[model samples]
Target: MVLLRGFLVLVMFFLLGEALRVLADLPVSGGVLGMVMVTFTLMLRGRVSDELAEASRGLISVLVLLIAPGVVGVFFIVEQFYGQWTTVIVALIAGTLLSVLTTLWLMKKVSESAAGDGRHE
Candidate 1:
């Protein structure tokens, strides 16, 4: 039941995000919006429940498999990218690197701020 509730929370956010996207005609994907909603909720709560953490851990374990279909779909359209291979590859690499760096920086900033709140550095 805990897992079920956790899953429902995720689905609820996703649906809410989709509704907002349709209503606002936003450029971002519903999934991204859902994540933003999740982030906001987590921030407001200030703590993650064990059930949600467990469910999120389970999702992380299968994240690669979740992305496999999209990666495979890219293969089907490989030819379209072939003509702009250089640009495509460069963009992919740059985007991935930027994402990694941004995530790392944010993590460091968050952790440091968290640590600073009542502990000597």
Candidate 2:
């Protein structure tokens, strides 16, 4: 019963995503939109059923395996990236550092705001 409910919820989201895709003519895929819709639903509902939780966990566990083929395909472009390894490494490092700094700054700002509101210890 739980699995059925979870499946129904997933199907509903997929349909909603497809509808959005059709109505808006967005370039994003239906599955990606479905995921976002699911996330929004979960956020609004707060708690999910055990079946849904289990289904999500099981799906996530195998998600990496599903993308393995795409990863393997990267081998075909190895030559194109080989000569640009230095550039790729530098871009990756810079992006990582920027993300980390941005996250830290945002966290500090949030904490300060909370403290100002007397919501902090």
Candidate 3:
């Protein structure tokens, strides 16, 4: 029930985004806009509900699978990327490193905050 509710919330946001995009004639995809909306809502709420957390956890576990199609599609565009392989490789490498560094920094900050909170108790 909790998982269902969480998924419902996500789907509702996506639908709302689709509506808004169609009405506003926005260039961004509905999914991306919906995600942004949900992110802002979550930020305003300050804390995640157990249902949403659980749903997110399940989704994370299968995230690679979810993106598999997009990854596979890249192979179909092999001809288009033939002349720009170097550029593509460099961008991918840089993006991966940046993501890793960002995650590392965030984790360190979070750990430090947790440690500080513990010391105050």
Candidate 4:
């Protein structure tokens, strides 16, 4: 019942986002917009409910299991990726590095600000 309620919250946000997309003719997808809305909601609320946290943890724990079929399917389409493998590899590596660096930089800045470092600004 707790998980159900949490899932319902997610669905509600998604539907809200979809409605806004259709009405406003926004460029972003419903899923992304939904995430943004939920993030703002959580920020305003300042704390996650126990049921939502539990549900989120449960979903994370089985995430790998959920993606297993897609990973397996990649092997079946290996030939399609052969010619473009170099491009794919480079893109993947660059994207990963960029994300890591960006995350580290943001964390540093946040920490500095939290520590009352005027230079952070």
Best by TM-score: 2
Candidate 2 global TM-score: 0.73
Q: Estimate, for each residue in 9-101, the C-alpha lDDT of model 3 and write its tens digit.
A: 888989999998999999999998898998999999998899888887888899999999999998899898788998989999999999999
The residue-by-residue lDDT of candidate 1 on 69-94, one tens digit each, is: 98999878878767798898899999
RMSD, candidate 3, Å: 5.6
**Candidate 2 local lDDT, 9-101, one digit each (tens):** 777888989999999999998889999988887899997778888767777889999999999988798787778988888999999999999
lDDT of 4 by residue, 42-75 (tens): 9999998987777778877999999999899988
Model 2 error, position 6 (Å): 2.8
Query: Could you arrange the candidates by TM-score from highest to lowest?
Result: 2, 1, 4, 3
Clashing pairs in 3: none
Per-candidate alpha-carbon RMSD to the true structure: 5.3, 3.2, 5.6, 4.0
Q: List the pairs of residues colliding in candidate 1.
A: none
lDDT of 4: 0.88
Worst 10 residues of 4 by lDDT: 112-121
Which scores better on TM-score, 3 or 4? Answer: 4
Q: Which residue pairs in model 4 clash with each other?
A: none
Arranged by lDDT with the best first, the candidates are 3, 1, 4, 2
Give me the displacement of residue 118 in model 3, in angstroms: 25
